[model samples]
Target: MRMAARPLAWLLLLGILLVTVLPIEWRPVTGEPANLERLVAFALVGFVFVVGYPRHWWLVLGLVIAVALGFELAQLLAPSRHATLKDAVVKVAGGSLGVTAGVAANFLFTRLVPR
Candidate 1:
């Protein structure tokens, strides 16, 4: 799983970028609130990144945050999309939570697992 983590994390990040900059009509609706979707999506991305690159957890956190801010700004490139500070905050909050969880999980795994 560790060996596959980096690639999977990168793939997920790419998907996030593509979805963020696409036309609103092209975005999928899961019946969930828009902010909720953003929160969960970014959370998952952050979690996967940390899990895949445990040794570079700090770098992962920073990169995830940068992505959150950058992606929110990217919405400006899409005429149909609007960028807002509120949305960016929510995404950053979610990613932070995920990265925290990932770090805790990594710590426990290293301490308890027969590595």
Candidate 2:
């Protein structure tokens, strides 16, 4: 049987992108996190990315990095949004952690469930 389409995660990611690119005042309340928001966002994004595409974890990492940098570059256009090197570092770190967890989870699931 063919598997059903799973685009919800990607839609969520797009939403995240929208929120990320918006001005600070325009963005929704994602919690008290102010400086660490980038980290959290990338972590969640990386997690979902790996969960959605379990092949080539490193490629996912690259994509996460590219996305992070792309958003940072996009921020240059918004006077309210300023992308810093520190924020980029935090984003990469968070994504790495999330991707590592995802890889572990995928490995465990594959081991537990017969293909």
* Top candidate by TM-score: 1
Model 1: pairs clashing at backbone N, Cα or C within 3 Å = none
- TM-scores of all candidate predictions against the true structure: 0.96, 0.84
Model 2 over residues 20-101: C-alpha lDDT tens digits?
Answer: 6888788987676755776777777777778778887889889888877777777788888888887778878878877888
lDDT of 1 at 35: 91
| CA lDDT scores, all candidates in order | 0.90, 0.75
After TM-score superposition, what is the CA distance of residue 91 in candidate 2 from its true location, in Å? 1.1
Residue by residue across 29-86, what tens digits does model 1's lDDT show? Answer: 8999999998998888888889999988889889989999999999998999999999
Cα lDDT of candidate 1 equals 0.90
TM-score of 2: 0.84
Worst 10 residues of 1 by lDDT: 1-10
